[model samples]
Target: MHRFYLPPDECLKDPPRLSERESHHALNVLRVRPRDRVVVLNGAGDELLCEVLNAERRALTLRIVQKNAIPPLPYQVTLVQAVARGKAMELIVQKATELGAHRIVPILSERTVAQVDAEAVPDKVEKWVASTVEALKQCGSAWLPRVEAPLTAQAFLARGDRFDLTFIASLQNEARHPREHFESFRSERERSPESVCVWVGPEGDFTPAEINAVRAAGALPITLGPLVLRSETAAIYSLSVINYELQSKRGQNGHLK
Candidate 1:
């Protein structure tokens, strides 16, 4: 069955209408027909089993058959990726979403090569979000990750400590892999953190000052492995590790730690 996102509010009634854009995709691009079974996601962990009712003139209507509430992940992971040039940035967004990042933030670091003017933030975020949406539909993710506006390193440093757990990818050999942090956290782990944020800097990576600031803000420095990884690779690989442990820590009891 094809999956699509329609916010819960918009799906108020049984025969709800898909939004203009999604309607066009369903009616024309996908050519969905009446009686076709489809899955509609509310992007808030709810999945509605629906049967197509009508598709006409670039409009779509669906009748809800069943609603399923997906259980939330054992832990939330946020990916803060430094802005990179061209396809690199999009790849970060796409792969991160597929790996189940709860939120995606494009950070503008001192060494960031991709610059987005203040006025362009909205459009850039929209593009980033569009990439995530594709991933969400393809990966069957019920919860949509929020794509935040570009944040400067300064802004990130100031509030980065807000997460229960935070990590900053570094090239320093002394830096530990994310598994180490998760293992340690799980060893005597009293409780799983509600949220975790992983930072991956761009190009030349973050400046010494930026690293120091993030470290001071309680963001632990960690490396993916022995080899230095591209910013996008670091984001996806690190998050994949975190996500795996998050899943494992949630035992059959439905509790982490």
Candidate 2:
């Protein structure tokens, strides 16, 4: 079934209507006709199975046929990613959404290649939001990850937000495999973490001082094997491992495959 996105508030209308952008895709692009079955997502865990009532250019009307409320993931996963060059950031956002990341924070590290001026942060964030929406529709995900304004690594660290388990991909000798940390957490706590965050540095990786600062802020150094992955690859790999260990139910009983 074709999918469309509507915010929670708009999804509640007596006869829900797609936004202008979505409307164009439904009416002109997809040529959805009356009585066609489609799915609408509120991006807040609500999925409305609806039938098209009208497909006007300006307004596409849909009547709810069924509504499914998917519970959010047991644990929240936050991706603190350094902005990569070119379109890599967008690709990361899309894959992160597909992997069920709860939130994404784009950071500007000292070695980041894609430099964004202060005034351009909003525009960059907007593009990232669009990427998430497209990903949601394509992947049939019920929840959309919140995209945060890009911030410097230092300023972001200053926020002092903590998670149940935190990781930073690093090449330092002290870094250990992600599985080791999961095993240690399971051994000590006897349960999977309720929330997790993984930090992925830019092309050249975080400066030693920045790495030390993150470590001081309670982030464990995680090694992504012997090979160094790009920023986007590291982000996807981190989220995948986290989803496997935490959301995949394998760790519920203190064992993860």
Candidate 3:
């Protein structure tokens, strides 16, 4: 079924209207017609199995056939990614959403090659947001990841938000293996944490001072093997591994996988 995300408040109306962008995608790109089965989702854990009533409007009129409230994932994942050059950031945002990142916060670090001027951040963030929407549709994900405005590494670290677990992927040998973090989590809680935040640095990796700042902010250092993956790759890879570790339920005892 085709899936599209609508804001939660709008999805509650009797006959919900698809947003202009969604309408264009359905009518122009997909050429959908009346009676076509589609699903309208609001990223806040609600979805409607609906049929198109009219595709001619700026907003498509949808006849909701079923309503469902999907419980949020047991573990909420936050990705703190340093902005990358070109379209790399969009790739990070798209895959992060597909892999189930509940939020994406772009950080500007000393090594970050991406431009972060005041006038540019909003436009860039908007494009990233659109990418998330498209990714949600393509991946059939009911949850949309919140993309925050780009902030400097210092400012982001200053927030000092606590999570059940926080980790920063690093290339240094001193960094513990990701397995260790997973094992520690299960050992401590008998299950995955209710929330996790993973930080992936920019192109050249975080400067020594930046690393210290993040560590001081309470993020544990973890490694993704020996290979030096690019910043965008690191972001997606970290999320994939975390999702696998937390999502896998093969062992009823929650033993180390």
Q: Which candidate ranks first by TM-score, i.e. highest? A: 2
Worst 10 residues of 1 by lDDT: 248-257
* Per-model lDDT: 0.83, 0.90, 0.86
Model 2 spans with C-alpha error above 4 angstroms: 248-257
TM-score for each predicted model, relative to the true structure: 0.93, 0.95, 0.93
Q: List the residue pairs that clash in candidate 2.
A: none
- As a whole number from 0 to 100, the lDDT of residue 194 in candidate 1 is 64
Evaluation by lDDT, superior candidate among 1 and 2: 2
- Report the C-alpha lDDT of model 1 over 15-93, residue by residue, as the tens digit: 6888888888887888788999899987788999999888866568889999999986766798888998888888889
Which has the higher TM-score value, candidate number 1 or candidate number 2? 2
Model 1: residues with Cα > 4 Å off, grouped in runs: 252-257
lDDT of 3: 0.86
TM-score, predicted candidate 1 vs. hidden true structure: 0.93
Sort all candidates by lDDT, best to worst: 2, 3, 1
lDDT of 2 at 190: 68
Q: Which residue pairs overlap in candidate 1's backbone? A: none
